[model samples]
Target: MSATTPNGAPASQPKKTPQIPKGKTELKILMLHGYTQSGPLFSSKTKALSKLLTKALSPAPYNLHPTLIFPTAPHRLRPSDIPGYTPSDGAEGAEAEEDDESDNWAWFRKDEATGTYLGFEAGMRAVATAIADAGGVDGVCGFSQGGAVAALVASALEKPHREPAPSPSPETDTSWLPLLRAANNDAPLKFCVVYSGFYAPPPTLGWLYAPPIATPTLHFLGSLDTVVEESRSQGLVDRCVDPTVVVHPGGHYVPVAKDWVLVLAGWLRKRYDEPAGTAKKEEGNL
Candidate 1:
């Protein structure tokens, strides 16, 4: 059939090419907040970094549009649960409600006596739901506790990363991995970026590092971070099969400066340019 113009005359059609160039590709990334923070708060802190990443990836051959999805942790902390939180004398009711509704959130609670991570599974479940809702994400970036969760998410998506539990117990819930895998349609994450991350000390989660994580990871550490020690971040670095570490002078925060953002953008570009199947081969090597 001929195409008709406004005047009812046949219009010429352009010839089709043998191979059409692909349109702009979306690189969806999950952003996880730190302990005592919410999604919006995290997003606001990383606004500059996000913008730089978007600008770097949105051009020419890359043609990648970076979409960042920030998801708050599911666990809410009580006044007592938060470090250094103190209620005013006789403060109650509305004051309590107001405090509860504010910036107190955690991915998991540390069992002080045993160093176990409580509520870890539930936190991962929330992340899995977020991934499914987004249809999936190419990668994840997190700060503090959320950074630890991001690493765990990377570990969970790759099945071979699981080794026998350090001490297997029937009570341990290892089922979240399947949920995460299914949520991402079994496609392993291309990368993970963690700021002030630490290793989960719980034996139940030891399987996560039974074989160190294979997904390419970029870890940012603070020289004077009092909240999460530099050693803690190094402990996590030691557990990654491939890790690129960046040390900044700041403390316990993601660096939003253009210089640091460019480092991340450069690393991401390299990962994106790697030939297909390289990631799987790297995973198999472990």
Candidate 2:
């Protein structure tokens, strides 16, 4: 049976917890999509990378199978809401936007004036719900806006038992912490990977950065990419206790090539304490 919302409506893309095999652990990764992208789209885009990761981790002392769950954000985005979307002079283009409305989604909308994320709590709730449905996840990965949310999720999971400050306001809404804990059964993520991610600068989000994120983080930056500048990505890297960074030649998208996929596999090996060269050896056989 599918999980439902408090109002009894079916939840968005409820994921089934993958069964763990004998002598092997189930490695669940929550894959969050970027602004304007949906879970299915992200899953399709990262298909190659996902396959490679699974193969890399399947062998020997590292008997791990990765099961990635891509969840669509709760907020729907209209054509006009997209960053580069311009009014169509042609009727066909306008009709296309209206017809394809369901593909566009966002975790939260940015309030340019206050530099805060509007509907941020709803976004967190959506993620927590996904976690609950899946029993829990071992890690998270995201791109662009979703990447920012990935960092927030990792930070929140680190110390979910923490209480809010004496006087809380809209800016500092830590209310989602407990809910997140309950959803994930109080499991802290083993690692997180962010592609084209940025830091939330609003004063309301200071609590997330003040203590800095301790979870192992891997950040990928595109040297020639202009969608999200390097400086912005650096801000996120700076906040991490000790983050691993990989600068790809591409821009604004997750790299799924063999080499890049191996880099990710290597990182995961390090995180899980698996011996090095396991992924490379397995790749050569493939």
Candidate 3:
């Protein structure tokens, strides 16, 4: 009836052990938030999607669970950098900058006249540190500016592994690439999820798209996204070898609706089916 330790003052019932299922799999994903959006804010925005991903992807035998990690961008944007900002909003924008502390964030800041990002190296370093600390991630997802960075990250991991070299000049420092490549236990990310992403047309980053992105990518585009136009998002799709595109009714935001999420889940399931250690088979679209 009862089992007790040494001293026989009283007897107690033995605790029943937990019956856990086997073959259950879990994956960690790195989420890059859009400009002006921090990690916590992005997490709140996609709470529904994260939950839906678990439910839809873990129906039974798959039993797939995902851990999403969001890392905030390091650069702080000026109030003038906010979208829809107008000169009439001068006083209000200043007040907003004084009131809000988290809105002005960016992965890279663009010089309007020159049309080039100024902080690419620093931003990439921050992302690389996050991935290295996580020991690696299964995939990456982003929206808007974050989506552009996600595409580059996946490309960086696709490069051949090499030991990081000495710090090079700002314009010439490709050293971070090797470090990011080495961070994933020397493996490339499994997939990428891009929402309203656009190609970054920079001379230094030309190598990223020289060979079409081989990683399996799922792109979400909004028909009415005025901020990052449909054409720009298509530009990124054109760089991927064979991308799965999902067009939704919304604009410039990740759709967390069940229907839209299921599309992502289906694509993810197909990716999971591929044998581990094997790169996704290239599909012709370029």
Candidate 4:
């Protein structure tokens, strides 16, 4: 259950890939599921993709052993008196009812007007801790609400530190930058992959200005995604500097196209395989 890097160093090993060969870095991906679903469900859907990536790149030139860390969404009650609590997918509806009965599990609830199930600040802190526990994350990937959260984390990590208040001049306002810098002091994220995610404005973020996230991001969208309109997703991508976009001809679900997975896998490999100093140099040029 342990992975090794190209230099024969041990990497984060998941149970699935028990006996990985030496000189291959174990690629640990933290996967956050979309709204109305849990981590296990997300893991199930991506099992094939994970296996394919693992098999395709086992040694040397493409040495990457991928592991998925699926975190459960915190629980919260469904909004009372909401007429259309039932999901379009029958299976999802049943699962929601089951959760309601158990009084646990939800990504977010509009009934209480809470933006996210665990509250934005608390949720980000939890995610940060999880990444740290994973020996520092290689990359962050998510779907829908999870995607939005991932983007938020990426943005927070790249924000530069600002000076304290009480400056002599009124033109010097460095309060917000300081807060963001503190939040992201530990590790800088390498890249991000977001599926069916939207970029909400600063007002929507409770007046918290989003810091520039220089991480190379890949955004995937379904042409017919009703839940998250293409325009909204594109807008989010537009805000990011030099983000890559992949469009699928399907709906809200992750594109089943094998090529997309391959591309993503390649991106991760390139980021992780390169020396840290080299990666930083390349990022600086960008």
Best candidate (score: TM-score): 2
- TM of each candidate vs. truth: 0.84, 0.86, 0.81, 0.70
Q: Candidate 4: minimum summed lDDT over ten consecutive residues — where?
A: 4-13
Minimal lDDT window, size 10, model 1:
9-18
User: Deviation in angstroms for 194 in model 2?
Assistant: 0.7
Candidate 4 lDDT over residue span 43-92, tens digit each: 78888777777876676787777767776555344533232564554566
lDDT over C-alpha atoms for residue 280 of model 1: 38
Q: What are the lDDT scores of the predictions, listed in order?
A: 0.80, 0.81, 0.76, 0.62
Query: Residue 164 in model 4: shift from native, Å?
Result: 12
Please report how far candidate 3 places residue 196 from its true position, in Å. 0.5
The collision pairs in model 1 are: none
**Taking the tens digit of each residue's C-alpha lDDT, what string does model 1 give over 44-97?**
999999899988887877788888888777777767677787778776675667
Candidate 2, which segments miss by more than 4 Å at Cα? 1-10, 13-22, 89-100, 160-163, 166-173, 274-286
Q: What TM-score does structure 4 among the candidates reach? A: 0.70
Q: Which one wins by lDDT: 3 or 4?
A: 3
For model 1, what is the error of residue 182's alpha carbon versus the real structure, in angstroms, after optimal superposition?
0.5
Query: For model 4, what is the C-alpha lDDT against the true structure?
Result: 0.62
Better of 2 and 4 by lDDT: 2
Candidate 3 residue-wise lDDT, 71-183, digit = tens: 77777665667777555635775656643443456789988887878888777877887787677888999889999999989887874532233333455676677667767
